[model samples]
Target: MLRRRRKFLEEGYNCALCQDGVEETIEHLFFSCSTSSCRWLVLGIFWNDGGNIFDKLSTAKQAFPFPFFMEVVMIGPWCIWKERNALTFNGKAPNLATWKNDFKKEVRGHLCRIKSSLHDSINFWLDAL
Candidate 1:
């Protein structure tokens, strides 16, 4: 559950990721926060922040090759979630380089499950990063 929901259910919850005292909603945590915006920008995904998460994702999907986009969609939020948990529970700070490394490692590990024909293309994309 998000801090916003937790606030309603209990008391005194704030966004652990940004530390900006904003109520943490799914949208804020994954899309609207400055940290998340920077991550999306690094991925070359820009949006107007006018729509819901699904709408934003749909727009982003149109911008990248489907296979690569799918991999990013699967791993990106998970990286963010993991970082959030690390901060919330272990008092670790969020690190963009750590997130990038984790994302790359995860995508590489998943290559065995992807079609061999796309491996070259995916490897090229990963190399460019």
Candidate 2:
């Protein structure tokens, strides 16, 4: 993204993803991209069916309420990206099942710090389950 950002600026474009055609900005790609993964982030294609990106990001950045439901969501895409790289570079096929399991493991491994920052603690467990 850094390279793309630099290149985009050098090319006088506002966005690498949209080529300055729309409201192209990093925030848009991060929280508003229409790509499947980004849409998943905003629309909860699998993890966040109850709200949009604004609500989700606010919840993820929360320092109160003791609900870590957002942590799982936050950590999920890293695992997905790793799987994406493995498939892209290793010539292996995608495996949603294994990817999900690994995502859970990864989330659990780093989720302790975020455990206290949730809207409802129970919601975290529900999401993990």
Candidate 3:
């Protein structure tokens, strides 16, 4: 449901987040866009322009513990999508602080659902951030 695909179906679709008039593909929105790139960089994840998000995740998975990586994979893009929606629908500008705060909030919330054994590891990772 990226703007690139939607553009094919309709017309005048552009990336809501960047507003750079680029066709918003899943890869572009979540991986390659400047906004997303900054987010990833802050997380210490540097994505190459070689492939899609999943491909990048596959490469990254080799570097990090799986559970922590999965948390990143889930929460990061969810924040990006929420930012996209905020801009697309509410005219709110993207805020990195807000994104970070939201990510922390989500990580904290997720802690309640996971096993207690992982709390220290997850909290350690979160603290490192």
Per-residue CA lDDT of model 2 for 1-129, tens digit only, reads 455445545665333333335454534444454432443443243323347767656655562333454565567556655654454345445565666567657765674565445435534553654
For candidate 3, what is the lDDT? 0.76
lDDT of 3 by residue, 34-75 (tens): 888888877776666687667787887776654667777778
Give the higher-lDDT candidate: 1 or 3.
3
lDDT of model 1, residue 64? 67
**Clash-forming residue pairs, model 1:** none
The models' CA-based lDDT, in order, is 0.75, 0.49, 0.76
Put the candidates in TM-score order, highest first: 1, 3, 2
What lDDT does candidate 2 reach at residue 24?
45
Candidate 3 residue runs with Cα over 4 Å from true position: 1-11, 65-67
What TM-score would every model get versus the actual structure?
A: 0.81, 0.44, 0.79
Candidate 2: worst 10 consecutive residues by lDDT? 39-48
Give candidate 1's error at residue 104 in angstroms: 0.5
